[model samples]
Target: MERYMSLLSPGDQPPALLGHEDIQAKLRKWITRRASGSEVSNSALIISLWGTEGAGKKTQLAHLGHYFNEPMLFVDMTKVPEEEREGPDALDNVFREAAIQQALPVLCGFLLQEDSEAMRNRKRELLDRLKTMSGIVFVLSEQPCQPIDLRSRIDLELEIPPLEGEKRSDAWRTLAAAYEVDESVDWGILASRFVFSPGQMSNAMRTARTLSEWRQEEGKSGPIRWSDMVEACYKQLNHHLDAKAKRLTPKKRWEDLVLPEAQTKKLRHACNHIQYKHTVYGLWGFDKKLSYGTGVSLLFSGPPGTGKTMAAEVVAKELDMEIYKIDLSQIISKYIGETEKNLREIFDEAEKSCAILFFDEADALFGKRSEVKDSHDKNANTEVAFLLQKIEEYGEYRLWRRTICKT
Candidate 1:
């Protein structure tokens, strides 16, 4: 059995849930209504909590049990014994067990997998069991449940959004207090530098404490310094974009880029946009007026080897951010929607890393939309449109470098 899957009684302490007050309030309301039997129409209430990994979906489920004040059974579907999962009465048995204990059944791993006959049968079994079972069933997923049959059965679909801005800073403060981190540490700086989820924040603090202990053993005395916490934060990030993009360490600074005075000024202006974005958006009230297109998007068009790439590096170095050169061959897929999916992953990872994205030879992907004569043409245009949308939605720096050939 997976260690994550287990039965917990009401006496177990609920995990500390941070930075999701809206979700907590919704869960509380739902549980209260169900408990009073006033809104009790369905035999079973299926609630799906979906978000990126480490966004505290499981923590929210634990919170639900605390609110419901009942026993809770947590099951990781991927870890269930094959014999039991394949068996016809397996789900029936599990639900029966939950019923016997009067526990809320919380199921994890509802991601879309291959639609095989066995998978279809499993979905059918789960649906039937859900229709017959009573009380609340919580489904945890990395993404929203996409299967129609299973999706329709979900009563409430709540997204545990990533902690951002002040909420993220607040989470850092809360975790720092719990871990007894140095009160003098600038949590706002840490929060600004790292776009970490609450779970990631906790893990970073744990790692920071471990580092501090090692320092004590080595006779190097000090509290958990800001540097230790920063290193820990970097260690917690799993870079999923390596497969799709190449990370470029920025070494070139402004002096290294030999450009015309006008071009150099333009580059400096772009860097300024990124540097003072928070001030301009938050303090200047631009964020309230503008809902999108807040990110800095710059186009570097010059002859090949005229320092287009170097200019990008200089910008990244100026902003003190990591730079990634997106691999067009790896990102543009022949299959419809695959390109968009790949872009989404790249954008998501870039956001977490707070890195500047550099798209070299951008004409191929961002060129004028081809006239639609067939489905392929239409799909290509759609892919470009989707890329543009993601670029606008991305709240960071995106630099596109295009070669301008002399005619």
Candidate 2:
């Protein structure tokens, strides 16, 4: 509870403790308790710093490591062998080592905690070794994992929350001080302009420092301009967002699309329905329940260079929504029912952003529904049915599902 100044030594750059006072306190308590050689149990403290990349996890980690006065060994789970990350084989090895060989002392106990008796014996060798090790272990993962398995052996699970309001200002002050900038600038206004992670903040400050020094060489006495800060923040946040589908705006007109008269007329009708719905559809008259399927579902049946794909892009451009082209190979998996899981990801992403779902050369998947003569046929039909159902359900809002025809 006391005001704790960081005891970080030279060469240890601790992250500026922004508005995370409560979080810092909790982490400090955990570190102190752990360092005293207390019986913390087999349960490991798993603190997950989750956010958009530029949201500052690395800087926070550095700061946290300094506060604890302990070296943080990062294990990037993403870099782990993908073959091992998937399937029963890798898990089998883990269990086997735990139950038979008494290896992987740190993770073996956690591995065998599962309820399955069959797995217990499979892992008994490894569990014996894990029962001896003490202290905390840290793993950094970009992708989500099966938490139940980890939770059984882990104790604490914390998600780093976003900074807001006063906390944002406090973060800026710390960042500015670390970078050595003129304190006269109002950072509260700047912080409100863009959201950045601690790592991003540090990088921006570092860049600003260099740029400011460069300006000083030219006899400029003022701190970094608001414009330069804006640019830095924009670059940092843009990288975090990644290369997302473009959000078409009003200014991006749809005049470039070359479609047949019927398709063009239908598209215009769909656009009108999307834009000015009440005047034409007679809002209350038509069943709103049916609106779920009201989303534009058009099959652009044509050869590759015939402008089918262009037409879909034009539609997205007109609607001011992002256009997402689903990868069919990824969608259609060889594993039974695995194809549906991939479909769920595509549909879920489209739903969240309300982006135009572009299924280029989609006849390969949505072929004429055939009788289920075999398991493959049955699975194919099921996939189609699932797709149809999802489109009918979540397509309540303005959505465009464009499928290009291949022959």
Candidate 3:
């Protein structure tokens, strides 16, 4: 029980919080108000920080502790036993620890798994306990609390947005400087190519350092190079996408893609959409105008053995990104809602890896909707709708190949 909790004293120096100046400012202002004894609520001030994993929620919590200028009790709720989790016993222990140490309680890992009556009751109880508490409390989650019961109780809910573009480049440079990485290593190129979270960037740098050390052990002595960092970043992304899609090494180049000049020009333009998206979208203010359909989605429709698959590889190689051939058999499911679940997983993994999704035989999934005569037909249409939504929502490149049979 004690192992699940740790005290983060004010003297303990955590890593610097990066790329969330707005969030940091809000947190500091909130803490300053509290410190000045300007109380708005009699109950505990619960600040909920929610975002994608590795988006630095814990880092924000640590920074929050620093702003509070007091000892903070860090509770990892995931480590608590399931039977005791959300129970009075666990709550009692947590409050007891915080009270004994005179520390602010920072609880993380509050994932709402289900919406059953029992779960609702447990959440209500938790809310009641939190509202009665008399100090500042922090809740960190990968997602915002969906339940109105819990959401209404939260005093402040700030989303820690993922680092992108310049922010990402800055994070790369900052971490490199902290880790004493080779200054010659081109972080800007790496940042542009990889849509990595700050946490991922840190992991990649550590892995790159390890690779450099391994080379030294084999009698090659040098600092971490660009190639080593690239390899390390790919290593961090490799495991998540393998289960859903088959990773393809893009061996095809533009010269190998034998198509008409007009068709070839269109393909190049499609590649440019991805290549210079930051310029067009970010720099030119197009991102503010469009809400959806920002991702580069290409539908390659042609007869069999006519280079649809080869074209996808060529585009991937042109962009210097890994391509994953999505396995239709693995994604499409017989059970209702299961297909959407699988698609969400695939898209999420693709986003993390920054890989091009190549869907071969894509018509099998994206075909015209049939008449709504049966339950199966409705489910099929639902799946298609969900797939289209995911494709539109995807921020990177997605290539789909449809085979047309010619009589």
Candidate 4:
């Protein structure tokens, strides 16, 4: 308890001692708040740091965390659970995590409290402060942020600028100290060969150290070579990038496609449009911007097993995106207006990863509108109109529409 008390003190912190020229302003601001007796505010603290590989963000964060003395929670946004993803309300998921950390527990605590009205109101006020107390420092590696609500919440954004000339020299010096490499090794030559993040650099150093000890135990006298460091860093970088791609596990490949030659060519062309990023809608004259018209819509009017779904998978694989086959039977409901809600969620979730929306039984949903005979008919027509609107707005992507005798 005594050790924890020093965390709240207004003394000069470790970050202020760092000789790095760029971090001085941030350091001053942090110390000034502490001196003023104000709790370090986390309300508007959305700091986003980004840069090319080996720009040294993780190193900077380590220094800053030591200065703050508060636990810095580095959330890898790229690794969100599937259930927390976009299907229903993603905002709810954010709230759920926040609540788990007692970020807004005071609100719930009031209901459970057996105190009188006056005491309960005072407790409620204390809870208000709790909402602002659980500050976060989330670090997203390379995750694609699709939902607007999620993007809007991020506050302060900083990128680790690309190192050149003297900055590169300084980075190498830092690496040397942390790595404990031989003085004979050429820093300039070694720095030029590798593209690594601070996290990768540290891991590589730790790995080299471990390897060196193992070799020493075997009575070997060779220094840790640059080749070994490169191989280790390469493996770590590959693992990180591959994990990002794994979020959307590809189900099928191009070979699984078994459509007619003509249909296959058209499907392949559509995939090319997405892959090469061809601007067919913009007539290819303009730079690859989508024209502001009805999006590239296509109708795959054919029998089942003719490779409509398989073609969709090829498009997903080519573009490096996800494919979500919509089960219309489950989505389409007997209750009025519920069908539209389900359809909206389907489109919304599909839009997050720019997923290929494969409506398996196309004719069932895209059937011709019936006459205005009864309430059920009118409701059914309304659902059809909504689906048509969503499909139209669903931009240039592989949309497979399977059919059977045209209903």
Task: Give the candidate number with the greatest TM-score.
Answer: 3
Per-residue C-alpha lDDT of model 3 across residues 183-279, encoded as one tens digit per residue? 6676655775677777888899899999999998999888897668878988877548888789898899998989999989999999877777767
Native-referenced Cα lDDT, model 3: 0.81
Which structure among the candidates has the greatest lDDT? 3
Q: List the candidates' TM-scores in order.
A: 0.72, 0.43, 0.78, 0.41
lDDT of each: 0.78, 0.53, 0.81, 0.50
Ranking by TM-score: 3, 1, 2, 4
- lDDT score of model 2? 0.53
Model 1 agreement with the true structure over 213-326: per-residue lDDT tens digits: 898899987789865786688788777767778889889988888888998988888877766665666446576788878788998887889898999899887766778898
Please provide, for model 2 over 47-159, each residue's C-alpha lDDT reduced to its tens digit, 9 standing for 90 to 100: 44444445545555566666655544333333434464344344343333323432211221123224466555433432233233344543333322243453444344455
Q: Clashes in model 4: which pairs?
A: 46-156, 48-158, 50-159, 50-160, 54-196
Clashes of 1: 0
**Descending-lDDT candidate ranking:** 3, 1, 2, 4
Show the lowest summed lDDT stretch of 10 residues, model 3.
Answer: 180-189
| TM-score: the better of candidates 1 and 3 | 3
Model 2 misplaced regions, further than 4 Å: 1-13, 31-39, 42-49, 52-69, 78-133, 142-150, 179-184, 214-221, 239-407
Q: After superposition, how far is residue 256 of candidate 1 from its true place, in Å?
A: 6.6
* lDDT digits (tens) for residues 1-407 of candidate 4: 12111121213243211124476357436544654555555452434454554455544655555555433333332354445433334324444444454331111101212356664443344333333444543333332222333334444445555553234435556765756565555444333334344445556667777776677789975676554454454445432222112233456777777667887787676666554432332224342343433334556766666666666666667655545566566678899999898877666654443345666666666668999899988998999999878877765453647576546
Per-residue lDDT value at 407 in model 3: 96
True-vs-predicted CA distance for residue 135, candidate 4, Å: 15
